[model samples]
Target chain A: MKPEEHQRRFENTDTLINEPIMAVDITRYCDWLAIMFYYGAAHLVDKHYAMRKRPFHPDNHSQRVDESRRLKRGNVVYKEFLLLYNAGLNARYEPIFYDQEDVKELKESYDAIKSILLTA
Target chain B: MESTLALSQSYKGLIADSILNILPYTLAKDQSNLLETPWGRHMGDGSYYTYNLLESVRQSIVDIPWWTIGESNNMSQDTCETELLDRLINGLLAFATTEKVIISQREESIAFWVVSSALDIMTQKKYCYFFADIVDKEFDTEYIFDFRIVSPSNRDLKRIPTDAQVYVRR
Candidate 1:
């Protein structure tokens, strides 16, 4: 996908991060929130890579992460992207729910990734 | 045929030796009678459920050092174990060299041990599979490890192995 398309997808779901606490059960939404944060971060990574003249489109999450680790700003991307991937995996597969605190921590990672990749 | 047989023997020896090393750890963790667990049933009938090679590959992990996952909120033991296992696998895979690494499954729990005949047998490799019915059967079930990423999709066995060379200390 084009960098613009990837960025648009990220921004589209990025809006869900602010879903009204009163409207829905935050606990139930924890999984959704984590996944949104993970993919949001993922899209940012994809966008940054896409902007390269020789685009890097990793076919899978692991590939995306492994390839991103070799990027110029690999250290930040590697750590934050991995944390998001694991958090999203746990939320979706394991019976674990992201408490508000866990979600908040994940959001910090997302923001860090956004600040770095969005600027790049 | 002789070469194939030799290769098979070598693989079993590697697996059995690896299990023997981690057996004490599992026992120390009070993971006895692992054959009694539901996962034990999945492992196989208790035909070879002893300290011997065929019987010793039952328990996947033992003595997990549990730490709090989230602050002020203690996660359940299951969650804690799962998280730690995830970390351990990820760490091992990330740092692992593409050597002859073995992945063993004990019921639902899984462990990875990087074994090389070139290394001293006494130089421990910290990976285990306990409660074995048949070494061949269990080996058939095991996945070859490198440092493949665990994604939701693309779970093909062939593509799973990544270049792993982790030296996890005891």
Candidate 2:
């Protein structure tokens, strides 16, 4: 299944219960579900970069990389995906609060990521 | 030089005071309760240690003397100039530790919600609200939190109210 599809499924699962116990369980499940989506998106970017035989270092600043060569192989989109993935990870593991608003933000990020993967 | 040193020390003290006051309620209790952690040896509830650290840094900055330029009588070149400002900003940011603190607090809140829900279910009550102390292992802090049901209903008080304690760590 597509990463978007899986993410949607996970989101749906979160809405399946009215019970507090169920809600707690679903919350934990959704947190992990989001992480899975990040992994999927990161892998897609890595694979696309590799297929084009592009020599790119993920750690290097984009400005340092030769833009002319990197842009030809869709490095920009992949780089964007990596940043979003990192943000999602931060939301998950960092000692910060993730409210409904944060969840909405993550959903938007996932949508953008999936779009990039699909077009690439 | 002495006056500058005093001013620097004052700013540091202000920042440390802010951290102690703002962060306790802001951070997860489990995360803030350093006494329970292995690193607990380094922290204390009082402000003395933090104050001393800030004072030392400030003093170092104030002790530096730079050459005064021509026609700038109001300004004296001292160590505690731009570098001091940068250090103050950085020090506050470091103390904020917003991400780690907030995340730990949220986890505690979630756990509180779950436990409150379970109690409601076990009692077969339509709704319930609870306040309890919870700890976050990651942040080594403790908090007394209020967890309430989103939905409300009428239920009788059949028995004398008794307090319950729940602990969640993973």
Candidate 3:
């Protein structure tokens, strides 16, 4: 991929992290809420993937989290990353509704992952 | 020179047939207007099911549709599950905006999780959701149900392989 391509990808990822995140109005939309969170966090993983010369798998949620956990093993960062990962998965898959608390956790996880991506 | 394709409304609604009257919903005001019993459980916008919409769904199952949901795939296309599934979603949407609900993004796995959970609740069957995308998605924007399990809460998430189950920590 060219540098311009990389820039475009990052731009796309940036939208994922920022847009609907600001638009989170109801718990019913949490499914989409979770998808946005996962896509944003996946970008953070992209940086690590590049560092290790691994081909980036940006759309695979479980793979990114597993690799993040393995790379950041024995660290507090992985826990936070996992929180966002689970929230995103739940929002997408489960019939169970997300409450105020779940949405708050999603915001926090997105923030943590965003901090890493912004610096990357 | 046109074919008038013949069709029959075969599948009878047991749940809808069973329902007598919709439990009256009152829009009350805390600050903004709220449902007399605000919907919860991912259907309504809020968290806890203070009025628990599922119970309402259970009650809304029509007492008599004056017809029966067909048992086989022969006559009508709708299955019992799909029939109940429609009611459940409509029940949930009764409180949402009148605007149409369009799924702009594709999350096949997650959508399966939602449908199965509702099926489990309605049928009272504990179908463990093994992680396999065996079901097919016929279109770019379609929800297809497949087998899989997601724990209500992730008490032992780390103990279970992430590949095995979807754990939603309560």
Candidate 4:
């Protein structure tokens, strides 16, 4: 996808993240929150590598974030991205691993990542 | 400059012991067959082997998927192995430090996933270094663990008490 398309998706996902918690337990969807934030950052970062004729598409969570790390070496986003990625994985796989407090910390990381990647 | 001195086998062993002692669960029960050979996955027309650590049955812990080693030059393999190991250690340590507690005790025995990569193959050196101190166990998901990354040299490793239980995963 073009950088503009990626930016659009990143902005859309940000809107979803900002949606207020209602009767539907937002805490239960904490995993999705982290996952969504990660993909938002992933797409934004993908703009850099997507220019290649044969662009790399990651197969798994690690591969996805690892690609971002490889492309943006020495960037704070790599560290924050891994934290969010791991949070999503742990929440999905590890039985009862999701803690609201932990996700809150990761949300801070997501904001930091967005400030870095989403800016012009 | 920080010493890039290679860690000896004994140091790795002790580090592994420390992790096992503090953490409630193990990676796998005697994963002898796991690391016997490198795993091969069909990347494109040909097979490619990676020194990648994988998740185990215990969730996100390291498990080597033993498959036939594919053709790759020794020089490239060595370089790849070194780079992968360094990345894993740095990433894991970063994750550990970010969270207040390294390992949390779950009501259902949720295992903490830790990955270790061998430094030297010729010397049969296995396991990566990590520090673990079990702080609390009574409450659910409230265990506090103190983890520190030691340099390649053994001099920096804080001595765990001899009486501290050491569980060796080999």
- TM-score of B chain for each model? 0.21, 0.16, 0.19, 0.19
Pick by TM-score: 1 or 2, better one: 1
Cα RMSD (Å) per model? 16.6, 19.9, 17.9, 18.5
Write candidate 1's Cα lDDT for B49-147 as tens digits.
343332335332122111111111211225444444344544443333323333443343243443222211111111111111111122222222122
Candidate 2 has an interface RMSD (Å) of 20.2
* Per-residue C-alpha lDDT of model 3 across residues A5-72, encoded as one tens digit per residue: 54467567667545654455544565666666666666556655655555555455544553453344
Taking the tens digit of each residue's C-alpha lDDT, what string does model 1 give over A2-114? 99999999898777676575122355576777788889888888888898989989877756754555555655666566667656755565444455666666677778878
User: Second chain of candidate 1: TM-score?
Assistant: 0.21
Q: List, residue by residue over B1-170, the lDDT tens digit for candidate 4.
A: 01221331234334434444433323332365443233445355332333121223223222311111111111122444335333433344344222211121223222233322211111111111221101111222222222222222323222433222121122
Q: Docking category for candidate 1? A: incorrect
Task: Tell me the tens digit of each residue's lDDT in model 4 across A14-109.
Answer: 778777851124566766776776677777777655655877655555455545544433246555665565555444544334446555766777
What stretches of model 3 exceed 4 Å from their correct place? Answer: A1-7, A20-22, A25-28, A53-60, A70-74, B1-149, B152-170
Task: Report the C-alpha lDDT of model 2 over A35-103, residue by residue, as the tens digit.
Answer: 554555554444444445444334432221112123333333433333344344444544334444444
Kindly report the fnat of each predicted structure, to 2 decimals. 0.00, 0.00, 0.02, 0.00
* TM-score (C-alpha, index-matched) for candidate 4: 0.43
Off by over 4 Å in 4: A22-28, A51-60, A70-73, B1-170
Off by over 4 Å in 1: A22-28, B1-170
Docking class of 4: incorrect
DockQ of the two-chain complex in candidate 4: 0.01
